[model samples]
Target: MPSDNVYPSSNGPSQVDDTIPIAQGQRTLFEFGSFDHSKIPLEPEEWPVIIIGSSMVGMTLGVLLGYHGIKSVSFDRHPSTAIHPRAALFLLRSVEIFRQLGLEDELRSESASNFDLDAGMIIVEKLVGGKVLASMQESDPAEVAKASPSRRLWLTQNMFEPLLRKRAKEFGAAQEFSETVVHYEELSDGVLVVVQNVQSKSYRKVKTKYLVSCDGNRSATRRKEGIEWQGPGVLGESISINFKADLTPYLGTRAKHGVTYISNPAIDAGFRLESGGKAGFMIVTRAGDKKSFSPDSVSERDAKRYFKEASGIEDDIDIKVDSISYWSVAAFNAERFMSANGRVFIAGDAAHVMPPTGGMGGNTGIQDVHNLAWKLAYVLREKASAALLRTYDAERRPVAGLLMRQAYSRLQKRVFRTVPDEPELPDIVCEIGYRYPSAAAAHIQNPNGDQYEDPHAPLVLPGSRLPHVLLSRDGSQISTLDLIKTNFVLLTTGQSSPWIEAAKGMTLEIDSYSINTDTGTVRDSEGTFSHICRISEGEAILVRPDGFIAWRGEWRKDGHRDELQKALERTLYLSGSKQL
Candidate 1:
């Protein structure tokens, strides 16, 4: 555990404007919430994507876009990385996104693997008492293997952000800390963002082709765009206290668990153990009797008392208090995910906010950027149509909507004690099974017989994620996903010679309800590509750049080439456009 009495030494804010000329009145920079961005870089690069909020969502988007060859500038008002452990749970889908970015091993190394496979859940009478309530040990290892190649984790945002920040910078992202975005205007072809240096009272404007809002709960970007948020109002408030204490004696043999839900009905609290079992923990407690418990209002004596009670350790324990924060367990999402022009978009807490119990907020935001970045890169490279941009809102909004619902359900049972275990199933579903209803689904033929249904099963659908399966080529083993590493591919059967010829000069495919075959080299040795998929032997699936099946086609006895070309042209928006 990091020193309880000592916080990390200042590492300074990231370079905001590298070689940006100070225009007269805009040169003022005042101390803001965190660090001051007085340091400037040597070269001023024109960013293609302007991302507000340098938290998990924004940083993830910045890195994803940057890695895909899009330059972006990300800014946050916080002086440094998150000092507190806010968002901790990492879903498998989020891991998949990082895996594609070549960050799988690095993340897994620091992940919380205590208890079971880092996927276990525990309920207890109290932290100090360590009395078991109803606990679900880790899932079967076989079931875990089926879940994903990238596993779920219990790492905190404070730890996660630094990795994302470094990767984003390495991938050509310009990041600024302690600089807050004040205003932004969506132009006809792009967006103009105005940000202020809180400390210096200085400001600057950044122009980019697109703007992504990852600004978190009180998103000014969402509010400024006149986007309406529709959902249930606030359920209640809780005090999230970040403190340090030796819980070895308290946890005893139970220290393996990452989260312990305190069933001490009186306080209605939950204790989250940070990566190391030593000290750091954030105790979420119901705002006592009064309306809300503001950290400022609580004296050290009272804070210590509440912390002890929440820990179920009323016995005197030397607890070093760090930072205290408060949060509302409300579930809501923007009625609209993007501006009228699609030049601006919202993700993360800006798009939807829910109780942190399910840890869907950060993961959903990561997926949001994953879905949008590739499209933005394709459009910028002229490989896709501008109309394709609309799919961001079309696809991600519903997933966020579902996640928000799941979060609330978890809060109902975990916090309010009103709902049942329904929250459990949705948590799994939202993490990996939520489907998209965008252009990808619209153009693809649902081989499952019904394209409109969202069974939430592990099968691959047009708009859903492609199924994971191991494959072999030239005696080297690889996952089926490796085929679509950075480009769209056409996966078909060896018998479908016509389909092969159809893809002679075009690409549209990958699928679960897929019609794939074990050809000479492309073999689904695990029966994944053959027996498990819904496709026939003489069909082909068109996968997009994001590994989504854009469309599937059956061999036309007359000829499949002409139809294949048209669908490829339509999906890529390359009908009359020149390829870059």
Candidate 2:
């Protein structure tokens, strides 16, 4: 446990004067505060983890860690909300994570529902000619729904961040606003971070076991570490405009034209994002050529001009400009995700960046946090060796690289050429196909076939998230995901005989769920018979705290007890009487 007062001592050279005032006029009201370095007792502080950046990746990491009882701190340089909305689509896997954090309802209530639409397509054309040149259709929504109940939610960054931040704060995460990282040094044991208050002319240094950088494409931490981003620099430039208006009258006749590619000889190419009866729409056009458009440069009048020209409408249309942003599409992967020093790690855009053609940015970042958080908790709690930390890089880097490639491929197909008959859109990669192949995963055999298999495939084997299976228990159909709470769940078939009796003397760390082998009857907490599992003779599977299979075998086998003990030992990192 760390004492609250253990602030960083003024280190070597004074690159920044402590008296310099940070610009706070641009910050929110809640962002005004000085660093509280009061020395407080370190009474087993929740997993002390520090995340830099407060966007989706940062907020997701904070909430997830907090849910697992890990104390987290997140910092962002921005005074208020981000002016530019980057990502707008949240994939199914992300929705599932939200469900785990008890935030699914809030997200569903706030964001636009997936409705019946499964996958969407991107269209490209010259804005002036209003001619469609190409289109890349995504996977069908009905097919995706049949595979899993989860669906992608469409919402802008503006609507999503506030909700996530609220949930994270509710779960005991300390979020510092208008605080920017000035400098960070990786000590042998932990990382020391120095942050400056934007309003007050004060600075504070925080020491934590691990530091995760969720900062965007221009990551200060990555720069400080001198890790170069390798790949194309500026692939293309795009101008995005968000406005509130009613374009339903014009679009109702051509709803199938969800994406209209305006190709005209006079203007640049562009596309439209329509939703909720055109309550709001985002129009994007390539930069340069005869048209002038930049997030910073484009004005309200300019936006109206482009919208009218693209939609071919002459009537006076009321448009409220919410925001305008300029983005440069590029494909880049960090030279490395984990530091050779091992105390600092990069995630989200900091690790890999891609074009928004596929909306893989936020989804991949959330997955990055998912991979890192649990491993950090395990290692910090001493349930696993520090070696587990290396797996973070091994697992996420490849996934990031693959996603970036997929995004680039989508970009190429959408821009330079037409959508092929069998367009290879890496939707699954963005959905759920990522897996960790480190020593931690080595315990289980790769049951899902190869790494390149469709990511949307159901997880049913060891090392994979248990697939959600429908089960009828107590006259109600339940999802397998609902069965596992925030603890290790041991599911067994048949009677709770000697096997259950033999495990009774141990600590109450495991929860048992038994089902009758013959009738598929489930024994709940109240000991009532409810049909859940198949209940076919033999032993059942034991799932780890993180939802991976620990062991499975017949209950009466001689080594069954030994296997259970081994599984417990490995999962909990317990040695003899000493528990990590």
Candidate 3:
């Protein structure tokens, strides 16, 4: 654990601007801090992990790390969660992760269930006329459910972020809003971070074992670390008009659809339901393909005009414009995710930026922190070596790169009417099918080169997500994924008692479960677990803490212990724990 001792460090504010936007709507209902900058402690502080930025990705990381019993402190320039409903789409894979944190019920209640709607994109002349120009279909609900326990949801960032902040607090993460990370210095043992109060301009230092920056695309930490971006930089920029208006009358039957693209000579934009259709927003200007509307220059008259025109409701309605925001549609990946010293890491938009056509930017970031949280916990607990932390960049960077290209391709095809020659993976595959590179799965040698596998037909291969299988525990139905939390798990059939016994001998906290057809520890009443997972009698699959398969093969009577030990040691870098 990192010490809570305080020491003085001198540094100026970061060159990057860290301005806090005004609080919006009922956002203050869930404000993280009191917004009193004078109350900020003058002395330096220390923590195991100090997170920069407390929005979606940062808050999620704090919650995840807290869930693993690791204390952390997060700082954000924002006065509250989110001033605007920035990103609204959450893939089923992302929701499944939320479900793991016991947030499924609250999220599903607050967000619109995509499964209940038509769940697809439609290009229309206007909301009232509904003259279709083009359309795209979403994945079948049945197909999606077969891959995970949760479905996709449409909750705006403004609504979603509060939940994460609350959960993070419940898990003992200290979130200090109106605080900006100004500068950080990496030491051989820890990092010294200086943060300034947005209102008071008071500066304080934080010393942490690890510093994670989730400060969005223009991450000061990433820039300070001199990480360069790869691929097409900024595709374009657009204006997002967030507002609360009853669109049901204008939408009418079109309300069933998830997203609507409004196209006409007057304006080209996209619309989506917010707060479960009680309110909504519009993305004006294709950005990459059209004019870049400046958020500052968008007057109330202009915003109302665009809103009414996009809705085809020129007749006045009670359209309350909440906020106007601007964003870039870009495809860029950082040259590297971690600083040279490896004490500072970047996740979410700081690490990779992709076009929003596929609604992957925030989802990808959620998975990025999910992949990292457990590894940090393991190393902090001395269960794994510091070397295990390096795999976070190796595993998540490639996945982010793949999604970046995939999202760019979708932007070209869906918005621009120009299909890229590069093959694009199906949306489900992009969300959950991505396979970690072979180097991340050091226990496996010469793994397949495929970037992703079909989620519908999961191979349960090493470096792949653990295949979802329905099993029963205490007569209650559960997913194989449910068995995974914050520890390595060894999954095998009832006949693989040798593997279970081998796991028992290890001092590490390795949870072993035996799935059986009729009678065993975990009953596979559906009798499809072995077939779906491709595991037979005497065969076992070793899963990592993050629920990715670390190793899988037939268990040998003479070498079961050695093989399991070797797999754990190699995958966790346990053999290289010189720091211990």
Candidate 4:
């Protein structure tokens, strides 16, 4: 139905400019054409991948693909990066993905604030001189460090997207704005897309081997593909008022509190501080019997009055209402993440939408593309079979379903103060401990095990993330997670020549590192590697490019090469048994 408005040549006179503006921060790494001044040639441009959105998720995918030497182009209807601070929290796993993409330091440096070790939620009748109702604490830093080398980030999406966009451009990924993907047709070999410029209404054709839609919840591509969402579509609605005010003086002893739930006769709202507690946003819900608030009806005066009531601040306090926005609190996951033909994939909010109570919406989307980008890179490079793409749906959709339930439950309890049937997993468990089924890893993973295990006492099982452990590589301290980035890793303990030999025989580049305290390859001086990972001498764990454990067992020289080869073949779908 979306393709019915195709702007074919017969639709109107051709006002084409024979040129298109260069994308923001774009660098000419791939020789796209012979046209002068880096302009379009008015012909169908073929790309390895064409992403339909250039927001956080789309830019992340582009950066990941470009890091793999895969060329991609991203198009978004917006003229630039996000203007509002959409998502404010990035979980540990999402931070880990950014770290893996070499953005950890930069992100932290640019973040408005980091969650303090003592950060938690405070409920009060008023911000100043009010009785506290309850206090809820987040996880401990020491506990989080045991599971991941990277910490959770509190940077807003508006600030974070530019970093990702710059990193993506550094890797030669192009990001075009003010362009919309009007229609697309999936072919046997690739996907043909019709892109229209917002200003000129001119159309251009792009042929990409794969099409990824990150176009938010109201995705045109998903609608065109006839993929429907399944879950509680809308739970509630509220208006978010983003403003600048130094509320630290009013917070007093609870200044370090990350979130403050304000409950009063005049207003019921939630306050989240940012910019080092100098700026923040308040989610204002309707007080009992109050009129339903709309963005159109709410003026700057109303926003300031709400802020003053929530903060219990004086009338003379300087509070600038920067923006007022409305949002639907919804929870849902798509019926499928991949198209019927498997050439088109949807990631981010397009595949799933959930409430932001737990800050998992954007993080889940970032991890979604982290799981898919490597598979796309491998398939596009012909290193893996097409069947590998099918695992994206099989693997991510279930995780999205679980996360949606978790988010909805959290919203119910936190915002509405009502308990739901969904059982709440621990924070670290929900963040990074969720495991995959054998459907993604083929026969190598446990299909019937629990979806998540205790991250503190990790099982180091297949389909789960490789547990993080502190190690010393050449006298420099590093995490076990630091070894995983671009290539598959074969990690073994003690002197394991057989694992190294097996890696050498593989056609794909697999880096083998033996953690030996004596030989000094990668020293596990504390034995935490053996204790946490549950691995001992002569045993090897095969880690996928995404840092999930694919296979782990004893590697004997008798048949080590054959065993590793079979594991890779089955896990990556190289055996040609499950081809689409």
Candidate 5:
């Protein structure tokens, strides 16, 4: 347990004065490398939401908020998207959110480069002529199809963050790189964020209705807010060498695969690497007590030597170092995800930390913002009450806690060999088991006491994702997920349930769609929706913008219109009779 003084006296590490701040108007790249500072504002940014990181999670928040016309700005101390091999794997849940922004196809194209290589992890005897120890499958296509239309993509943060950044900007969000949030405060009404240009050492104040801290594990915002994380801290440190080499000699026909793990007792450390196509491999191994891999300290020779020794290569291979990084593995969950008044919130590693073994650190963070973004948008747009915002923590913390433990457990299984190496949690369970319990969700039947239930179970009880079902929308085939938008969706059957009438008096963006109604209803070509979601003719399913089931109308309910209206009112926290 972290002591009370762990955070009571420290607001995280402060930016030590760079021996010298970049001189004003000087035309050289700053100490942190290069960033397009042209778009950075000289004046303070005033937006509805201020995100203090341009990480994948932060960018997703910006994109989601922008799509909803809720202006937001993101700032990062780093010059640009991760140059190092940080978080790479993205789950279908993250893909679904990107799909909403119309970037899913583009993302799929990027990951198509080495799909087979990404099939699973391979434990080898060595990088060169190594014996295969084990092969782990990340997901089973058949089981995955039953839960979600989207599947996990093997794309690194370096390759995909820019796509999100571009899409975010397209959706009207602004970004500032090399700008760090040094301080922040939640006032009676809004949050005031203080950001500084690392190069110029100049600061500006941003005042916004909300402040979302998507910064990493050592989050300054979280620390300043006195939000302490709970869980075993800092598992250990590792060296990640982003080096380019012709591994064709070693992997040969299997070069197209993404991940390769080498184990050799002769070598002091083993290699866990993911391929970066022509770019290179992001290799990780235990770091020395006093030495770490860094662009500044690691020379080409050093990187190649480290790679050769860890990979058990007898001869020095021709390798070029790109950018080396050292990172600590930790599993931590914040004491609380939100401040008392809810003016400030934390997401991503700022809220929780996870080991890289599960490839869920970044994916989980993306989902976090996706979950919070809409609720914040609705509250800001006046579609939902302020109380709805409280669900952000109530919903995400449980999942975060579970994922933290799971990631740590995976690391022990893979690295330390202290735990059973049976298999990681089933893909469906890790990706979709989490359910929200709050005013925003109304489980009308078979409510489970657990925060997360087995996703592989054949049920779409309220609060879970409306199971992916094939439906025909007009002439095109689409999944049940495609029907969900940035607002509430009331799904019913061919009878054109009363939900359509009930939404008439509502101010919310609630649209009614029936499975097989002749009056402009989407046809359930396969009857999958009815069978999987357990909905027959008279039943109704109300889905939130995030695609979680908000309410379920019992099959025999004679008058569901009023029930739906009341349920909507309760779920959305509407003060009056007005509802969807």
Candidate 6:
């Protein structure tokens, strides 16, 4: 439905300058005119990838595609901040991804310190007419530390987005603000997006090979495409208010213990410290019986009343109201993540929205972008078949379904106050348990007969994530994850000439490294992968470009060359003859 105009005639906003100021030493982020298009080997007619919405998902996708040497355009409707007081928890896996993008330090610096909080779930019971509740004690920090290497950070969406936006600009996929997509049409080869700049009052049509809708729950693209979400709608309303008043004074001793959940019938509230106490305090309240609670409806007086009722605080409470907003606990999965017209796709809330019980929503969206980024790059670079894109839906849809189910489960557990006898935490439910069922994983056979049927268990199968393990080779301890550096790694448990030959043949195009476990050394002349791949048996494994294992077997086994060729073909989407 977008207009046929290739470029709009009018300029940007009159109030704001059309041209952005160039940094003192740094060059302008991206070139805008036709000349910029001509610089690439691809013609202007080549479809550009346009990502709608500039949330974390959109920003991540744009940055990844840009890093992969793909031309992409990202646009958002809002001039500045639209959503507020959103997702506060970023999981460990997300941290790993951020580390890879080199934004981990910036995120850590800008965001809050996670170590201070006692994040485990707690149960509470209120005595008649009493303000204090019989609350469970916080988990010991040392004990919680033993569960996982990474802990979820407590940071608001406001703090997180700016970092992502800045990083996206640094990666050369700077997003355009105040640009709303009016309409879009999917052509045979690309998608045409008609966008209007709300600030400038101008319009332009962009042709993109692929179009991704990272727009939130009420996505315009999804609606226009007649994609109906098929799950539970707004289950309950929750109010989040940001205040400066330290509740710690009231609960002098309890404050030392973190994340107190008040369960009194009169007042149900959850409180946590934000940004190591620098970004004020966060108070969450379930809008009991109220179908909806809007920011406009909840006055400052109401907040004060609730705070007093929740925590017997009547003393001189100096509170600065930063912002307050109501959120819906909705659970819905898109009927389809990808359009039948292959050029269109959806990620994040646009594809699925879940209740924020386990903080699965944001992390799932992050994974969605991670999955799509490489696939898009592969297709664009002609390294793989277009069919590889279909695998995205296959792999992610099921994962989304599982996440929603987990969210519901977590919600039930929270509501019922179900305390397990052992109090075992389902850590892997939101952690590194997701597996891709594409051709890459399909090629893997469980040779060791099924003893453990737990699908969510850490993957040790071929073509799966090589589980992290600690190793000390010649006194230097190294992690298994360090060996993988965004390239193919052939991990050999023993000497194998054929494997080396295959790796050498593909070294011209693909980055291939052979690790000889017998000698505790890798093919990298710089000795980067040597310490990481410390296998000392006859069994060997091959990892794909994205860190997942591509093949695993004993060295020089029967049909070893044939199986290796098949694995390479499936992993890289290359023909049999292409495997030299």
Which candidate would rank higher by lDDT, 5 or 6?
A: 5
Ten contiguous residues minimizing lDDT sum, candidate 6: 12-21
Clashing pairs in 5: 117-257, 117-258
Candidates' C-alpha lDDT:
0.67, 0.61, 0.78, 0.78, 0.70, 0.60
- Write candidate 3's Cα lDDT for 53-117 as tens digits: 88899999999999899999998876777656677889877988888888988898887443234
Q: Identify the runs in model 4 with alpha carbons over 4 angstroms from their true place.
A: 1-44, 112-118, 290-295, 445-448, 555-557, 576-580
Model 5, position 192: C-alpha lDDT score: 65
TM-score of 4: 0.89
CA displacement after TM-score superposition, residue 86 of candidate 2 (Å)? 3.1
Q: Mind giving the per-residue lDDT tens digits that candidate 6 earns over 1-580?
A: 1111111222210111111121282323222122222222323554457898887788888877776667677888766543355677677667656765667677776654532444444444321123443344443445433333344566667678876877676676868887877767778888766767876776776677899999877665666666777765556556666676645434444444345565665566666555333334444445344435543456666666666655555576777655555555677888888888788899998888886667788888988887787778877877766777886787687778677767766655665356522232454534564555545543555454321212233445653455554434455654455565545566654355455555555522444334533444433333433333334344556765455566665545455556666766676666766643
- Estimate, for each residue in 284-351, the C-alpha lDDT of model 2 and write its tens digit: 44433543232235556766677776666566978776655555577888888878889899999888
Q: Is candidate 2 or candidate 4 better by TM-score?
A: 4
How well does candidate 4 score on lDDT at residue 356? 81
Better of 1 and 2 by lDDT: 1
lDDT of 1: 0.67
Candidate 5 lDDT over residue span 1-580, tens digit each: 1111111112121111111111272323222222344444545556899888887888888988888779999988777775445566777788887777788899988777644434567667666677777777666778777677887887777788877776777888899988877666678888766678878998776689999988766665666667777887766555565666666566664454446666556332443344433345545554334322322344455556667755666766676665545466667898888888888899988898877777788888988888898899988977778888888888898888877887878777766667643345665677777776644686343455655667656457676877778888767888888888887898877565665666665666687887763546488787566777788777788888888888877765456556767887788788655544
Better of 3 and 6 by TM-score: 3
lDDT by residue for model 1 over 89-187, one digit each (tens)? Answer: 788788877888888788887773432335456777667775677776654556655655667777787888887777777888778987877766677
Q: Which lDDT tens digits does candidate 4 get at residues 433-457? A: 8887756564555545677778888
